[model samples]
Target: MKTKIILVIIIVLCTFFIGMMLFIKYYSPKEKSNQLLSNVSVVDGKQIISITAKGGYFPRITNAKADIPTTIKLNTKATFDCSSAIVIPGINYRSYLPPSGETIIDIPSQKAGSSMNGTCSMGMYGFVINFN
Candidate 1:
């Protein structure tokens, strides 16, 4: 009788452990990583450009009419492209006033499980362009 009781207890314990493991493996919440990119255009005489970007990323525009500043929030490694062109940091990233024409800029996020926030200057006829 004692042997049978021990065996039953062992089985029950094993079953409980296995169920718990499975639950944790399949039902536990998971962390999600996402990337977002957007395109924005600031025309001459405009002070701000408000547009919704994908992947929960939003670009804040400051001084849109003069020395425009753009702020972007990123959750993961992403790439922002405009007019099929890629813009590099600290290099011609600024747009001229009366904004000669539309300038495309690309922002790329290349890391996992990371978020990035940055501010840059923009000008009229400047576009956030595209991202991935």
Candidate 2:
């Protein structure tokens, strides 16, 4: 019957739409953040870099001053993904971040033109900090 065929087509279309939505939500690349300028600050002569880690690290790229003692803060709120497992190979740092809190790692003063990179445990998500 035409009615039956139409109903089947509708159901198939709905299913396809839902599947695509789910894939885009969890499997698609992360959106870039526009908070780069606000994420870095100097407090009492020490540089502080703030990054939010949820589905992935935000701001993807951070710019900061070099040759200053620095602390990188990884903030998380209800993060249950691989991004919580942060790894910074340059400093030999690796750890599992809490689900809802902040993790701070001290970084020594870096020479200008150097950079540091952090990635999730699975290496599926990452971010970079450039010193200038």
Candidate 3:
């Protein structure tokens, strides 16, 4: 019957759309907002690394110089999600970022060829800073 044929077509279309959504959500590479990324810089003998936090950390990976005073400048804008609760295990740093603002954290100079990792409180989002 025509009803049976139409039903089959509907089912096929639904399945195909669901499959595409799943593939895009799980298999795709998700990185950043792109427009918000800021370049790292040094000033007055201090290295400042800028990172944006929202749904997740932008520029999930970063590279910086080693053996210098370093400051991690975290920026958040209207961020109220779990990503706002950041945890930097390498330096034993943990805190909740403001809904919209900047938070600066300082640490001693890192050794060459070292890396530091930071993640959300729930471990769902993270970023890494590699020293060279």
* Top of the candidates by TM-score: 2
Candidate 1 or 2, higher TM-score?
A: 2
Compared with the true structure, the alpha-carbon lDDT of candidate 2 equals: 0.93
* Candidate lDDT values, in order: 0.35, 0.93, 0.91
- Name the regions of candidate 1 deviating beyond 4 angstroms: 29-71, 74-132
Candidate 3 lDDT over 60-128, as tens digits, reads: 999889999999999999998999999999999999999999999998999999999999999999999
Q: After superposition, how far is residue 116 of candidate 2 from its true place, in Å?
A: 0.2
The per-residue C-alpha lDDT of model 1 at residue 39 equals 28
- Least accurate 10 contiguous residues by lDDT in model 2: 27-36
TM-score of each: 0.30, 0.73, 0.71
Best by lDDT: 2
Q: Which 10 residues in a row give candidate 3 its minimum summed lDDT?
A: 29-38
Cα lDDT tens digits, model 1, 1-132, are 999999999999999999999887766533211121222343452222333322222443222222343333222223242211222243344332121233333333323332223232322112232221
The deviation in Å at residue 63 for candidate 2 is 0.5
Model 1 quality (TM-score): 0.30
Q: Is candidate 1 or candidate 2 better by lDDT?
A: 2
Residue-level lDDT tens digits of model 2 in 2-85 = 999999999999999999999887665343233346799999999999999999999799999999999999999999999999
Q: Which lDDT value does model 3 have at 22?
A: 90
**What clash pairs does model 2 have?**
none
